[model samples]
Target: MTPKEYFKQAYRLDKRIDSQVVKLGELRALAGCAQTISYEEKIGSPNRNTEAPFVKVLEKVYLLENHINEQIDKFVDLKYQMADAIETLPNVDLGLVLDYRYLQGMTWEKIAEVMNADVRTIYRWHTKALQLVQMPENPIII
Candidate 1:
């Protein structure tokens, strides 16, 4: 595989890892909320009336939380690995474009607006960035 394609794949993987992290954070918050609600129910119900159901539900929530946390950790590790690989190359523009387009989830038009360039220019930059990543030794700076 070409080095540029390799870098692009790394960048895509980084984006996926980032997305998983956000999902994991949401899942963790949900789990915490569920646990708190269960705790409140347990406390309100006197004579330990809801003890069994509360324990059952809490167990499930804890399990899900553990699963989500594990996935988040895995993704975080992957992000670091990909970042390290990309760091070996010298083309910073490729990294910048990928960050703005994929990580920031910005449209090409929006990216052009932010860069104060025409949409066609931004498209050209992105294309060149992809190519440069493939062969950093003789890059065509856009």
Candidate 2:
């Protein structure tokens, strides 16, 4: 894949992951609310210790959530950086390939169906896209 295509794919993946992050954030907020409610209930009852372990668990959850958020932020920043790097390519056919494959999380066969191309073509586009955006001295797409 060309660097531009790779960038496009990375951007697409970042977007999809961003949405998932938002949903996870909402869930974390809901869990926090539930934890608060549990604590309040325990305060009025004799199960305060039962709530104690939960509070600790909630703390760990928040910690992991924070880590995930940080990772997402980094990914988003990388997306923008890559976009800036490959802004000159106007004939980029792999843009959609990247979007469908990474951002939309579509399988190669599915992308082939949507683009009216064969799976082999889609795979070629995907690989070309990755090559465009590949980091120096690193094969990792992300």
lDDT, model 2, position 28: 66
Stretches of model 2 off by over 4 angstroms after superposition? 1-51, 82-90, 130-142
- Consecutive 10-residue window with the lowest summed lDDT within model 1: 133-142
| Local accuracy of candidate 1 as per-residue lDDT tens digits, 49-85 | 6454346555665676676576556545544454554
Q: lDDT by residue for model 2 over 17-127, one digit each (tens)?
A: 677677666666666664324334333556545454456656766776777777677676665555444343344667677666655557878899999999998888767
Give RMSD (Å) of candidate 1 vs. truth.
Answer: 8.9
Total clashes in model 1, counting residue pairs 3 or more apart in sequence or in different chains? 2
Highest TM-score scorer:
1
Global fold similarity of model 1 (TM-score)? 0.50
Q: Distance from true position, residue 79, model 1, in Å?
A: 2.9
